[model samples]
Structure formats: structure tokens, C-alpha cells
Target: MPKSNVKKMLFILSKATIENVYAAFIMANGARMEGIEAEIFFTFFGLEAIQKKKLEHLHVATVGNPAMHMPTMLGGLPGMEALATKMMKKEMEKLDMPPIGEFLEILSDSGCKLWACKLAVEMFHLEEKDLIDDLDGILTIGDFYSRATEDNTQMLFV
Candidate 1:
């Protein structure tokens, strides 16, 4: 096969649900594995993935998730979300997927840039200490866009 033209991948994660967070993580990791530059911009609720305390407690979105094959009412029941999150975590463990905290470390060690959104940090009243140690730093949207100024760079929102 011919070599891929893509040189870099930029991912914007705006959701905190475990599934959405993992999607961005997996894709960015894949890009780095292929020797492509990768970066993740965490904004809105996505910041939870990079928070020191919240990362470990991220849960699956059981309610209103049609893929769960359950009624919305059933999903809303007490403990349903916890149960679903538990099951998902078990499956992820089987697949050798690391938990959020370790995964962030791996991404950082592998040279995948992790940036928190400046506006979101301010809105959430978060200090730098509130974020994961692996985070590169907080950045404005314009600063993030400037990182994408290379040819064959691609951006994705998750």
C-alpha cells in the first residue's frame, strides 16, 4: 500500500462520557503509533478526562444511549449507570485498555500533546493544579488552531 499523506492529527474532545473520551484517546494513540503527530484539546466536559480526581470516576452514559439496547426509563434507574460503567471497564480491561489516568500518562510519554481549554478552565473555576500532571498546558482555541498550520494535518471533534 502507498504511504498515507497525513502527518498530524488533532482531536477536540468536548464530552466527559467514558465512551466519547475513549474514542478520542484511542484515535490519538493510534495516530502516534503510526508516527503521526497527535494532539488532544480538552474542552467543556471533556476536561474531566484530564482532571486529577475526575478521571478515575468517569462513567458510561447509560441513559438515552440507544446502543445499550434498554429503555430510557430503565437506564435512568438507580445503579444502572454504575453497572454499565463497571461492565464497560471490565471489558476494556480484557482488551488491555488502560484506565483514564494511566492512559493519559501513556499518551504523554508517547509525545501526544494534551491541552486543556483556557476558556473552559476559567468557566469551571479550575486552577492548573486541578488538571492532570501530564497535561502540556492550557491553551486558547486560537493557539490550538495555530498548531494545525502544517500541510496534511487533520482535525476531528469527538
Candidate 2:
């Protein structure tokens, strides 16, 4: 496709939780597969989704999240989130979806850009080394705004 025809998409991830991360990546990869330019900007708690240590441990919230359908009381039970995470992973496997680690590699290989927030890193006491090595690097909100404000860029805050 020509530069004049490229479609740009920006996904803003604000939650550190599991379901949100999955949704963001699913959308980003879908856009890339459709020949649309995609960039996922991780800010605030969303940084946790990219952290090497916590990324794999991400679990969908069982409660307090309106979509999960579980009672709020059940969500507080010990090990419930872990159990939910396992269930989710199992379902993903059945669907042939790659694990989180492999999924990140897929995004990178597919030309989907990944970036973390500079302010979030400082506030969370995290260094660049803490995130996946494939990252494009930390981007300032100002930087994101300028790019996202460009012509034909569609921004979605997940």
C-alpha cells in the first residue's frame, strides 16, 4: 500500500489487569493483520501488562468488572483470581492462541509498535530493563499526542 493509503491506529492501555491487556493486543494484532498501522501506548497501571515479571501473571478480574459476571464476594476469595487466570489460559490454548510471551513476539514480528510511558516508569521505579527488550522505548504523553493527532489516526483507549 502507498503512504497515502496507510491506516493508523493507536491503542491506549490504562489498566494493568489481564482481560484488558488481552483485548488491547487482540485489537492491535487484528489491525495489523488488516494492513492498518497499529501502536499500543502503555501508561499508568497499563505498564504492568508489559512488565516481564507481571505480564505472564496477568489475570482477568473476576469481580468489580461488569463483564465477568461473578459476584463481588466471590472475587475476594483467596486464589480465585489465580483460578480464573488458569481457566482463561486454558481456554486460550483450546483456541490455539499463543501464550502471553509468544503473543508479544507475534505483535512485534507483525509490525505492531509497542511503547511504554516514561512517566509511569519513573513513578513505578522501573527501569527500561524491566520491560520486554523488543519495546520501541518509553514515550512521553506529548509525543503520543502529536502522533495520534495526525491525519487519519484512530485512537482507542482500552
Candidate 3:
């Protein structure tokens, strides 16, 4: 593989579904493992992953998700999302994947920064206390942009 020039990764997560959140988390974790600096900016529905009360309760978004391979109507039925999420979690557990909260802690302890989008936080009427203890802070887009002062920094919207 060619050596990567990228030294930093900035992820903007805008969805709350377990799949979307996991995508960001896994990429950030991979970056850290590769000695790259990494950060996640939680925005829109993605803030749910950071919310103290909601992170553990995140479910797979079954409805209207083509990848779920179920009819939209069936996916929207009561308990369908829960059943899918439960099955996914069981599979994750079998692979020794840590739960959301634990994954956040691991990322934090590994020096990956986690930030909540200020606008989204305000829109949701959430206080700092409502977020995980590992959160670095809430930031505006400008503030987040400033963090990429070095060369070879990459931004990704997930």
C-alpha cells in the first residue's frame, strides 16, 4: 500500500442510527490505531450518540433503509427496529465489539477528540451536562475548521 500523507481525520457525523454512528467511530478508531490524529464532530441526529441518556439506546434505522433488505412497511412495523438492533448487538458481542459507551471511552482515552456541534446542541436544547463526560466540548463549524491548521488534514462527512 502507498504511504498515506494524511495525518489527521475529522469526521462529521449527522445521523443517529447505529450503523452511521459505528461507521464514524470505527474510522476514527482505525485512524488512531494507525497513529493518525482523529476527531468526531457530532451534528444533527448524530448527537444522539453522545447524549448521556440516548447513546446506549440507539437502534438500527430499519425503515427506508435499502440495505436492510426488508420492505419499508415491514421495517416500519412495531418492534422491527428493535429486533434488528438486538440481533446486530448480539453479533457484535460475539465479535467482542464494545458497546457504544465503552467505544466512546476507548476513543477518548486513545486521544481521539469528540465534539458536539454547537448549533445542533442548541437546536436540541441540550446542555453540556446532557453529553458524555468524554466530550471535549461543543464547537461551531468555524471552530472545528480551525482545528485543521496542519497540512494533510482530511475532513469526512459520515
Models, CA RMSD each:
0.7, 2.8, 0.8
Question: Per-residue CA lDDT of candidate 2, range 109-153, in tens?
Answer: 999989998898899999988999889889998888777655788
The better-scoring model by TM-score among 2 and 3 is 3
| Model 3 lDDT per residue over 67-89, tens place | 99989999999999999999999
Pairs that collide, model 1: none
RMSD of 3: 0.8
Model 2 global lDDT (CA atoms, 0 to 1):
0.86
Cα error, candidate 2, residue 1 (Å):
17
Better of 1 and 3 by TM-score: 1
Off by over 4 Å in 3: none
Each model's C-alpha lDDT? Answer: 0.96, 0.86, 0.96
Model 2 CA lDDT for position 2:
42
